[model samples]
Target chain A: MSPEKVQGGLEPSETVAIVGASLAGGACITRLRELGFTGRIQAIDCDPFAPYDRPPLSKRFLAQNTEIETPRWWSPDCEVIRARAVAFDAQRRALRLRDTSGAERNISADAVVIATGAQPRRLPIEPDGVFALRTAGDALALRHAVDAGAKHVAVIGAGVLGTEIASSLRQQDLQVSMVDAASLPLVRLLGRGMGARAIDWMKEWNVDLHLGVRIESIRCDHGVCAVTLGSGVAIESDLIISAVGARPAVDWLINSGLAIRDGVLCDASGSALSMGHNVVPRVYVAGDVASVECPNGSFARDESWTGAKQQGVKVAETMYYGAQQTVQPEPPYFWTEQFGRRVQILGRVSENGAVSCVKSVPDRNGGLFKVAESGAHVAWIAINAPSLFAQVKAGLLP
Target chain B: MKVALDAKRCQGHARCAAFAPETFVFDDEGFSRVREGFENVKPELQEKVRRACTNCPEGAITISG
Candidate 1:
């Protein structure tokens, strides 16, 4: 859903207040109108510019400083609130806002969609040249450093985000060293062998790899920076990137008095599941701020673009169709183009290094590994080959 | 008796995944994705499943033997 679509959902909505004016919020608004929702639609975004894509902040946006070529990922024109959300009143169905002037306005509505997204996790030690890759503002800050051709960047995590950042930095000729506490670059999810392959790729690119180590503290002085490891090794760096992880953007809801565990907990239907299943009729949460409950009653906090968009659509469906229609969890998939390899994984991957078989595509120098016991096909990961990925994904659907 | 997750809680935390990965692979979110031979699982494998339950960070698994 884009900005143009959201403006259309306005006619049907008696009064719709989307607390988040970003991607998910923008998409929800567009989708609602697209589905024939006609009512008052209000989108509140903390950032001045209307919603844009964030994934690029780590890759293309960093590699190339060009604005979106065409699809803005938003409608042509939507009322972007450019205001920060301060609080929420579930009973009154109003959202508190502090505009650029610092004036407070309690905006009320029939449907309140909370889409306040997560911010980057900052390190406690605070190295002078340290940075994060979350918001566009953060990207701009890092972009200057990259454009300035700052050499020798130390990426603090081996996760996808960190790896991508490292790759982008490397493309700019900055010597990058990716250090992680995990045994492998992607140890928490992909097993050690997969991690080894990641290391192999990084090594091929000459990005220094420091696996199975902990950074005790980071210190910076003037233009130089250094990080001390638990092993008593000092790594000198020009820039330090803390790409550890992210927590929920649940501060406003925390004082709002709604049920929150990690994030605003919602049931399978996207409704605020107060006290676990006695659904509140009007309130809803979507995106990084919401904890979606699977059909089995266990909740998981997701901070991915796909999860946010999928849940945003689901929330709209639940509102229009009603809660009885259950939406099963879709297959979780994410991909990254990094270090001269496009790495993609579908289905679940074991961290303990389990491999049923690795089928190689001799032509492309890639292989597809079948995760055993995963039914007909659990997941298929491909490196540098997308055709094989498609074949496996299409065949995996039960 | 041994317990298994309902495929939802099994977000590959893999705490319980160490048991018999050949028997318990995961869904994209890292949960117990496949339903395998809980009945025919070897004794040691069953015990591994029990340990997975203990290590699960989200407390998404439980086992009895």
Candidate 2:
């Protein structure tokens, strides 16, 4: 395994600055050390607290106040900088950081990794006191709101995060109402069959359904919040949470000389691409901020938790070992815990593929497999059946 | 070397089982556990187990000497 470094790759003594102490950034730092890279890692964390796991923020963290401390691996051989990366100088491999006190400074490194992840998208008519879950502080604020006698909650957007937030709030005995423009929740990702099933689950959970409707306006007046729909009907709640979706946190890299469509475009190895010029010197993008070029010659930004973690590892391997490893990209996978059931999706589901229920139990514990005409399993969605999902994901299902 | 899977922490991301299928077993709900006999770790399987431990999002796997 002793191989020369790729052209322009970082040396063991070089320092790497990771902007955004996100899952991808965290994973990259850990994997680099595991790969025997002795480079100094600067972890730039924007959060007030140290880097902590975010998945629980919408799950157990809000529902039960479980404390998720920073992982033990982040402390050793790494400098934790509590600052936000304001700008990136790709040409000079430098970053402009703005600390909590509004102080700004420029620090340079041999290699730069952008793992800023994404921020929750707000509604056009978002009023004051609207809640959006992205960080630990945001989760705490929501929990505080609930603790402060928040009974009825209106959640906008029925996407994964929104749905999970709704489920979590419901677990607290809060009356939750969900509003989305799509006719069905997760219709784009799960398609009609599985999406319909999702609707059924939400309905069964007693979440006030406001699907297939446009939110005209949101107003919080006199201690009551009203979400007005396009049909002139309004659903009143004590609080409103805007979870329409999220946009990649690539605003800082706008002038970084890297190509940006939806996100910072990168090659399969996570190397940031610069149009009409040689690739930006050792500047890589991973996690939600990276729009990675896939084997099929298409660019995709995988915003899921698993995708971010895998990309973190892959980018670290490329940065340290010089991209020689021809590892196959792991299939895209994400799971949502809603209504106390774990719904997981693995692999790509072709738009026109046939989706059939391979095995289903009355308790909503089963697998839904998607396949093209070639008879190969293209995608699988398992509800409350993790073991079976793992088997089918490992190609055990013939 | 020995490894332990914290049942409380495992939210069933299943990256452990994916990385080291022989060493990690999945429960019905998709959470992972270090296989019974393999918790002690074999010499050849140590690397895979390490990878699994690192890849786990939940950080449920613990490796100790």
Candidate 3:
């Protein structure tokens, strides 16, 4: 909380620069304006398009044949610059940016928000007709491929995104086979019982689940990909979608002296943490690019849309209030739509936790609750039962 | 202040309940709702209610007098 540790507070006339211009950056800028901050704001992004939500990329946006509209949140007075930040000068609080034309520029600001987000993790052998969805363009390209008669799809990784894509494709009458190295998809997040339930749902949706197998090689010929599993079984498909998760887009922060681990390491208050445990002044991080360490000593990189937006507001507050204002940390929240059902999860559920069905009916399939070994309610998962989820969430609150 | 919730957009994050437990309550399925008789947040808890609305990631909560 020292001013020298995390830099001085913001002044009314000082300029604040934000990188990424994705959900987190958009939230930060919009919240700042909502709070009536008159300081100069510079929002930067490499993409030509304005800020947009990414959740629909795999669901509605990909399934529909309509135009994708970018969500507008910035004020008329705010400056939106289309450029990629190449480097950061911590001492001077300036960033070196490269425009689309390859022209370079330097912008100095009193505070900087790194919301660069993340990019999809690719496999070692990327053959033709392989796709990964992270941005709007990626989704559009995959949709176009599907529309172009790509019949059978082999989705690698059965996590949230992969399962979601598989489910969506099934709804569109496209044959989908989902492969995952884990014994059960989402086991790490939902634990054994709940994760097994997800498997049952996927089977019910007719998605071929190839679990506990490693992909040996991917060979593509004439717009068709033949994926050979470790068991010497080959699965052929018209296209392959790799939803193997994402890593923080932190290439620009390298060599800038910031402690780069899985993502930009930050304290709970959203200030960037250096290698020696000191806060890097004026540098705040949010969204997928930020791995925040809580007081409990564990670090979490919440890649959900909700986490990104919440962190964005917190980081903006830290920039304006100089870390003096204690941020009330919210529970981790995430939701996914697939198999014509909405799966909503709130709070953290450990792998060994005991899960029980809090509510069960023909309409509501997944109202399961997990409690820690200490009998503390840890997490709740609901399928199309948002109100039930909310009830469980409220009871867990202090 | 009058507190409103865009129930459809709420993903049952429960952040609103955490910030203002007295003003907000959870529906049977876990989405947020104004307490049984607290549709208009009490004057003493209005600030906390506002914080709850502000922290909602879905932007589902709103407050206006």
Task: Give Cα-based local distance difference scores for all models.
Answer: 0.68, 0.82, 0.80
lDDT tens digits by residue: candidate 3, A60-162: 7766554555453334457889999999876577899999999998989889899999999888787756899998788888998999999999999988899
lDDT of 1 by residue, B1-65 (tens): 56656554333433344445555665543345435556445675664564354334334564546
Chain B of candidate 3 versus the native chain B: what TM-score? 0.90
How large is the i-RMS for each model, in angstroms? 14.5, 2.5, 3.8
* The 10-residue segment with the lowest total lDDT in model 2 chain B: B26-35
TM-score of 3: 0.87
Q: Which one wins by TM-score: 1 or 3?
A: 3
Deviation in Å, model 3, residue A68 alpha carbon: 3.6
DockQ order of candidates, top first: 2, 3, 1
TM-score of the candidate numbered 2?
0.94
B-chain TM-score of model 1: 0.61
- Compared with the true structure, the alpha-carbon lDDT of candidate 1 equals 0.68
lDDT of 2 at A220: 82
Q: Per-prediction fnat values?
A: 0.00, 0.51, 0.60
Winning model by TM-score: 2
Q: Each candidate's chain A: what TM-score?
A: 0.90, 0.94, 0.93
List TM-scores for all candidates, in order.
0.78, 0.94, 0.87
